[model samples]
Target: MNGPGCAAGFRHHTRYARSMSGNRKRILIVGGGYVGLVTALRLQKLLRRQLKRGEVEIVVVDPRSFMTYQPFLPEASAGSLEPRHVVVPLRRVLDKCDVRTARVTRIDHARRIATLAPHVGDPYDLRYDELVVGVGAVPRTLPIPGLAEFGIGFKTIEEAIGLRNRVLDKLDEADALPYSDPRFRELRARLLTFVFVGGGFAGVEALAELEDMARDACRLYNEVKREDMRWVLVEAAGKIIPEFGEELSDYTRQRLEERGIEVKLNTRLESCVNGHIVLSDGTEFDADTLVWTAGVKPNPMLRDTDLPLGPKGHVVCLPTLQVKDTPHAWAAGDCAQVPDLAKGPGAYCPPTAQHGVRQAKHLARNIQRVMQGKPPTPFKHKNKGAVAGLGLHKGVANLLGWIHLKGWPAWFVHRTYHLYAVPTLNRKVRTVVDWTLALFFRREIVSLGTLHSPREEFAEVAAESAPQPEAASRTPGQPVPKAGAPKAG
Candidate 1:
């Protein structure tokens, strides 16, 4: 699609050639994720002149209709932004590209064919002249018993909404019953006893925001006290936010402790049996909520593919972002292990969103060059450092080169960078509005508990009131003794 906002024009079906007698090649891209969208969008613009050849077609396949900007997810969960704004619709942004909302079940580079699992119905095969694999990462889950059944993963927009609903509903359950009821108090504590694993960006921000929200909500409940609830963060490492350096980790730890959150460093989640969470440290905790954000591995789709893979299951891409020796195929994002040319140490770039975005732009340019028979340039980006949000208007950041920031300044950077990075003007404005509204309005403290079981309570009552033929037969006004009459006579 061509637009004023777009850097260049993009058309998908047609191929670019110098003459009308064009033998156009087809480009097949996998995973309509962040890296995939950017690569396709950039190629459409860079190779606009090429698509006019009417020979080459570009096909993008993925399960999601939209690409979610994950950094804004915490704010979305915290009610700091509307949920809808965090996702960018695939069809609206990539014009002229054949966007297929399907999963790529298998890829055979040896034969240059990809098998696609359609969103519904039958599966089909798509043969392409070139292939791009940008299948992003998935949640890294352990084999701990009840991990999948009892615990929730903090990935994607769906899980974010689920967490919010579950949290509010638990609060409502606590408040609905009389304060004197033990079940009511136990439920209230269970609701607030939320546990999060992993101390990375996802774990820290989620823990802090939810902790802040819960602490504020305690003001509204007469029985639920701030001290009564527990917020535990379990990290296998010795410190939280290791990217923030030693001092910042200490600072964050202090900040959380002040908020009454317990940080369990050098710990592991052993099991979650019947919501009773046992730790490697021999500590046991019974929680109604458990969130796992330990880490992530590349999508398993790469395992069966013919492309070369790294030790971590990431695609082996050259400095040019092309699959090693395969000039036609390219990859990026968490799924690709692109080498850092500048370092000269043969080190792979970290699996981070920063690297992913940078690689996408480079890959876009290289694809354009490849389509035009021009030599592709290699990708080399300097480390830009890292930043993290600890809680509302508070954070820590390591700026470009080596400058470290903390308190409000770091928080400002965190907000500014994320707000700028959040795709589309509509989402940006809506997020600002959510924050502004929060300044004036009281935090929405009312939890809609009935949403969990709108009918179960009534069903229980109905079952109790249901008529019993045995009881009715024995009632004073009921006829009974017909069979026994002959015997009595």
Candidate 2:
């Protein structure tokens, strides 16, 4: 609720009352992440001027006021892009819609009410004539012995930037200590070792780019060498990059191995007790950073609601995006398991950003159709391709079939597609600028440790240099007056 360091916060209830004239039919939206923000924007554009006729009002609720461009996160953490550019202000962009920086704690489909926990105020229930469930997914973490306390999830922009700083900070700390001391050197070696647990896009791309960045960064350090840093990517599955199919996954593994990254397969992290990575195969290594991006599950809030869910806790919907056997209720994004008509089997659309974006547009039209007393259209989409950037000018991609691509071309497609798809033109320009600058300049690895405590350095310096009681009023290089004497005056 302490809104992710975006523009502070605004209380929209008072402002919205002024817009209400107390009659527009309300649309209450939950979860203002990617799916929520896009859906609300489309609804606002579609339901324009209806408020004047008291026909429609839209309210969106989320814990934060920003929608994170998740795809750019790995690049941002690797210093390829600025962290600020990856997050868009939801309230500023969706001003016409009532936006609340609150999280929905519970939902009641039968009563059409959503219980929410606002950023500052007490719990309250919002009633709406129409509803949308875009409440996205969270990082699927396991109950590893010490994971909860030591592991970091790559979800929010803050977390991404924090991870970047934390990673770079470890480097700074390790190198700060003299390498002549064995204990200090061992600590430095451990800090430089990074462990990534997952073989999916998040894990692969993150491990690849972050490793690339750290390798490049080591040149600046006096004693730290690229060989001293160990990047271990652990996958429980047999291969990496499942989107690329088995052969390409093998290619990915080979590419990582060529770069001296250890790709451990059929492996599980036994324990990270005291920041040491103990493996299931009796392999042990000391690591200071552990990243978790393995997978995602549907929002658990669905269990308490009356809406019917599929096998995986997803809201069971027909071809149309409407809730099964329910009226005026809808769910999409990762939360609803919309049946994939294209797959021919009982396949539901996999929760990917590509599908989520497409579904949002169709959903908007469907909602508009339903509002106008027309039948809603079914949601169906065929995936064209999947691409991932694995550092500055390296990657592997599968466009249609097993048509594999690696190196510069794959990386370019990854950037170009994400640049076009990420939200507003302002953000698009910023992302372009990030890439453009990448061409002429070197990526900076300096960590601004002041972010953790801006005043600690100043406080320490002040304590070290502060004048004694007898010299409190003295000027630099000037003789201090004695406590009881007139002194130099």
Candidate 3:
């Protein structure tokens, strides 16, 4: 490991020596996503002795302080789960490690330093002996017109809750207007229309869950009817959820269509300027809500580092999960192109929660081996199948290759897998409580959009109570008149 770059990094400055004083080595993990969080948890247990004796240090850096469990986001958006229970706070879980709420601006592996920028403080440099890159992917957006200004993404917990508010608020606004009014004909239709541009799990599941919730909500409104709403799903590929196998993909499409959703396959979105959509199939319409979940790309921050990257802007990793030809640097998850040893020479593992959790454990064990002057082992995990939920009691799952289930059976499996996967026993209990309570009562349909602008009312009151300027009739040296006291004519 003592190559030219590695040696220079050690000798670049005295800060490195200061950080390593008393033989304590710092392991810097650059992300707080699923992989980073899991790796830190495993390492804290595996290196318990070193951490206790001040011989090792682990630091996790991310802009946000919590790690979101993304699989349950659909349920949260549909009001089946509370938004607060969908994220795991890093500080509460990693008691033995240092958790820094900051973003990594740049990485200089040649000097073993990383630049960090917090939300409020100035940027500073952090030195580390071992590095892990797990900064995950961002939404893959197209150059289509109006997408940046109009489309919403379904990535974070905040976004999921915000989408819920937006949908319910739209229904409320449309219900208050008169449907027979000619002037509101087009506006009412726009308010009732919802468009989703993606057929992947995130897009399909979100649409299904939200649609079901909205349909149930219609019963509470006297003016709103379920038949008046329009739901359209547009996919560029010939099929939706290609990873679910051809048979299951067809089944999912049929289920969605049975619920009055228009599935447009082999079609593309041309434009959506000013809420007017024009598709590649010449279907033009007006909609108030548009969601983009097409795909995701690797974090762009990798370009600013000294690591060797793959052609698709991902860090290249060998089967052992080490950055190709770069010592003391490792990467996994969506940001790294880890060779799939289970699939043979030319294949790579798909970016999913199943692969990520297993890789994190393997990487943690490998790091301990390297620290003890032992060789690292390769990471290998076979693909387990995929499961997805559609609305309330409908779903589909393909386990291994021979086991196929649909409807209630698949939905139950979907819930069972994610519930078992969510970190921390505290969170698992809270989530289960939410689900249990939901069985006796209907899902909440109230929209809390005011949470976004809670200070607006206070600001308005403050503006009205502000002191008024002195009257023009008063002398220059005289005392100024109080607000609302009296005004000279």
Number of the top candidate by lDDT?
Answer: 3
Supply candidate 1's per-residue lDDT for 443. Answer: 59
Residue pairs with backbone overlap in model 3: none
Ten contiguous residues with the weakest lDDT in model 3:
5-14
Q: lDDT: which is higher, 2 or 3? A: 3
Per-residue lDDT of model 2, residues 7-72, tens digit only: 232345434444555656788888887778888888878877675565887888888888998999
Where model 2 places Cα greater than 4 Å from the true spot, the runs are 1-23, 180-185, 455-489
TM-score of each: 0.85, 0.89, 0.93
TM-score of 1: 0.85
Candidate with better lDDT, 1 vs 2: 2
Q: What does candidate 3 score in Cα RMSD to the true structure? A: 5.5
Residue-pair clashes per candidate: 6, 0, 0
Order of candidates by lDDT, top first? 3, 2, 1
In candidate 1, how many clashes are counted?
Answer: 6
Local distance difference test scores for all models: 0.80, 0.83, 0.91
Candidate 1: deviation at residue 136, Å? Answer: 0.9
